[model samples]
Target chain A: MTPRRSERSGPTMHDVARSAGVSQATVSLVLNDVEGSRVSAETRARVLAAVAQLGYRVNSAAKSLREGHSRLLGFIGDNVASTPFAGEIIEGAQDRAWADGHLMLIVNTGGDRDLEERGIDSLLSRQVDGIVYAAMYHRRLKVPAALREVPTVVLNAETEDGSLPAVVPDEYAGGRAATRHLIDHGHERIAFININTLESGLPAVVERERGFVDAIEDAGLKLDRTLVKRGDGDAETAYRHAARLLDRKRRPTAIFCANDRTAWGAYQAAADLGLRIPDDVSVIGFDNQTLIAAHLRPGLTTMALPFAEMGRRGVARLLAGGSGAGVDAVECPLVERGSVGDR
Target chain B: MTPRRSERSGPTMHDVARSAGVSQATVSLVLNDVEGSRVSAETRARVLAAVAQLGYRVNSAAKSLREGHSRLLGFIGDNVASTPFAGEIIEGAQDRAWADGHLMLIVNTGGDRDLEERGIDSLLSRQVDGIVYAAMYHRRLKVPAALREVPTVVLNAETEDGSLPAVVPDEYAGGRAATRHLIDHGHERIAFININTLESGLPAVVERERGFVDAIEDAGLKLDRTLVKRGDGDAETAYRHAARLLDRKRRPTAIFCANDRTAWGAYQAAADLGLRIPDDVSVIGFDNQTLIAAHLRPGLTTMALPFAEMGRRGVARLLAGGSGAGVDAVECPLVERGSVGDR
Candidate 1:
């Protein structure tokens, strides 16, 4: 009998009850807390001791299924396969979620309708408390209809009609601050270079471009059409655009890049044209991507998008049930480096 | 009858069955796939049509509890919360996992015992099929004992005792290749600068140092201890360490950095001392970190560790149910840039 007992695996509720001299129902009541029937403290302690000694384990999956909520939150990124920016957002969201006793279930949607819809369905089926839809940029988005029923927050992007609650940087302020910084340093004849995207619509891009133009107008500087170029949101495009600007008879004293990558392209074009930074043509960029800005020859002077902060606050808002109708914006600050100098 | 129907708000299986003209049992059979019960193609099609029309949803939590395994894989990254390198690894792992019909559950342990243990426990509770533990670097590791029961593969970190499986870059080969590149260019004297971490045991460092020493020893050249410096794995530390090396009476004709970041530090130190890259002294580094290397005055010539490939393969190995007890060393290739020049 002893040898057979040793050969048997870990004990279950039945074994615990039998050893404790109680009914299995009582043990179940004590473990599951059946409100109607209560067990004595002595009996409960004995059952617990037997269970501990026998190494009884509760099946978490069974418990979760019964509880209806899995204590899991999901994050669906539009396209994390291309950019490192979304990674910071994930880190921020994960950190906050982990601290609150929840695990983050993440999926990269690859911007596919089927994949995005499937991801939302899976997260919902898993009974996630909330879902976070994060995009690489603030694009006018057409969210999957399935997710409309679930509690979701859009990060770094806004709703098409501004109905969904979203969190994004105050790009207009960031642009204004960068231009102001350049203007205060006694530089005029500034040009704005940007990428043409639906997200970079006449609204977002124009907001930044307008901020730059406004600063120039306010400073009483002449605004020239030849200086304002569209980079198509890429390095090669920005490089060509910057090359065209620099090759013209009268180059603008300064150029404001839409983003850091484009600014890097402008820097390369400037370098290729034998113009020195600050001395030949001052360059300013947005988004202080540390990896790029730090290593650039003179380093890039740009604004730092509050990616981590936005992610952190976005998670906080989602957890606090801050879902209603409308979008929220955050402000990004300018980071001064060597790329901008006095005229 | 129509007015009475208003009292019943929730959907029922009969409604779905009626909508598709299928029997309740057939609908259940198609939707739940009750084991051993096969439904005809016509019945399955009808059930699916009914489901789509009525927006029928299955309770995945209950199903997963019954099935004992969720279509989810867990990845525990070593401090992904603070670094970008881990981001690349995660993106690679997630993309591969997504293609294989599995969702990735990411847990950032932040290099803590309790957190690491909780991360694994959370995965187990979710009933994930396998886990991938990705560390930031290849070095000795202390994997939690509780994880031995679950199938797991380590990435970017090798086993302390080689018995555990790991996938890391071939550092020895990388070191030899870097030294050979410098040597082939007719550099007689060379120096190696590295970072100091407890996990980076003498064996791995010695392997690289041996490669550098061997390249010099084979050529009957003197290996100066004064030129060999350790950066302690940071820009400030590497800056100071390289500064000391440059201050020496007899400096090596060229210096090899242990990693790209450390190399960036060395490059800064060289610039501060007015030593032109490849003109006064040639410099080479390992780990082609694009953010750091691409922006250097002379782009860094270094080896690109196959982190993405390792990530892809690590997930694949876990999904294939391979025992986590083997080593898979990936090759690191050299990326030519302006940092290293022919002496």
Candidate 2:
């Protein structure tokens, strides 16, 4: 259901430039975030405000006319094997695009940048309206030279210098929510289990740990070193790490898992040790993978990362015309169910 | 990513038709399941055997050339909003497609046939190589007019006549496995929760129930009508249904849910009723949705539907000149976790 954009009329890029009292090229460069060019924050803000006030909309067809090919948005990501969130993001984007009468051409790059480049080239050969560099998580993004002219949005990935537009989940906030849930339930000894992965000199696991620690510290609770367990990102490793922590002399009453998959491993480990969840040891995980979390015996209480929302909004923004805007962050929501026990 | 056809020699559609002692049109009709045409059981088998022997391949590019777009495939139907199975199907198809030189231009029909037709039109206007009518479950499929000439493979869905290639989970085996697990654990008073939906008329679910009944009848166990629960294809309804069944005077020692989502709801119901899982009653669910089942407190033991494998196999079949081959079925494997318990 590709949207027919001619059905709607609104302010175009030229209109936004005119209203913002800036040149058309500057408006595009400033709004789209073309590399090697700098625009004052004040001017960029003015242009954005003008866009908002005038209800400025992007005519992907017009852009495609100028460039050739319909502005086919390219989403580069892995299949279900590597990232569970890819499907949701693609769905959200498709839904949004359908409403706007725009078509998106997605390519699964299989974790290879060269393949990603070739995919982008295919999209380019078709004269895509824009390109969306969406990954499975908030990992470091690598921008290719061929995509410079296209309006681009990086989904679930971070950009250097905040020059490229990116949309990702707020992992730190999600961790805080999980920790707060456990603390409010009268649990004093809490543990954090996370995978070890580095992204842009910072690990997603560490950031989540920081948020959990911050919550505990804010509550005046002691954070013990014995309570923190780092998994190697595999179910076996996570299960082993959790077993070691739970079988300790003074184990934490509640455990916060890095993600749903890791939480699954933790569940197996607990079951193997005959630890009843929420009674012997309560468990909470991040990223509410609907299928696994819901079907778990005592359904997993986890945070729902806005993967679909991020993909939808990112594509919406790109299609709506804000290629030059800096990264935008979406909040993750908590889905409470049966995993956590009442202390 | 779309895989380009191998420039090497391969068996053509003509080769399969010639070896099968059938007309080329007959082979296409049999494989595509054109209505108002009858393909004998023996003839269908012979064509498939010929295809297998010759190693014949369908040139998606050539097919698209005959029709007009790239040798791109289109998949309709999205269960991501409710079930996690659709993701794996797309993932499997996408991954296999990259190597086979065909790109799947997936359109999320969101479970609406009209929207599906629109998606079909969008694909056909561009001249697609073929179309794959993928359903979330194995139910009667209504062929759309737009799919008249496009080679199609129905996934988790079946037609009135078993003339088309279709891939579905082996439900009878899945049910047998679940029941066998419980029976081995010494459970006698077992209840089955079936999903009540238009598609519940699905042969797969029927086979599962048949298997369950067979196991119980074989054991000569008295089945209670009050214990059988039916969920309205949702977690909330499943919760309510499970609550009613579990609250009975003589609650079953074990329960089997139709799908993972239903199990999630049932888990919530059991928790709300203050019953400890496997202590009061053990529960098992179908469809091993890793994200949901694995993360549950007790971990859900379930049957894994081969969505990825089906998608991969479907694409492989399409490329292998099995495009018009009749009625192909794939097997679903079982995955055991902690949900099921000894009676």
Q: What tens-digit string does per-residue lDDT give for candidate 2 at B299-326?
A: 8888888888988877776655445546
Categorize the docking of model 2.
incorrect
Best by TM-score: 1
Candidate 2 lDDT over residue span A186-235, tens digit each: 89999888777434344367678878989999999998877787776556
Candidate that scores best on DockQ: 1
RMSD of each: 6.3, 15.3
- Which residue pairs collide, candidate 1? none
RMSD of model 2, in Å?
15.3
Fnat scores for every prediction: 0.36, 0.12
Can you give the lDDT of residue B183 in candidate 2? 84
Q: Residue B105 lDDT in model 2? A: 70
lDDT of 1 by residue, B1-343 (tens): 0011122223567889899887887887888877878787887887898788887677666665555556678899878755657667877788788787677889987788888888887787666777889987676687887566556788988667665567787777888889888988989778888766424574346666667777778777787777777767656677787787786777777888887878877886887787888888888888777766666667889988777788888888877773747788778898999977777
In order of appearance, the predictions have TM-scores of 0.79, 0.64
Give the TM-score comparing model 1 with the true structure, all chains together. 0.79
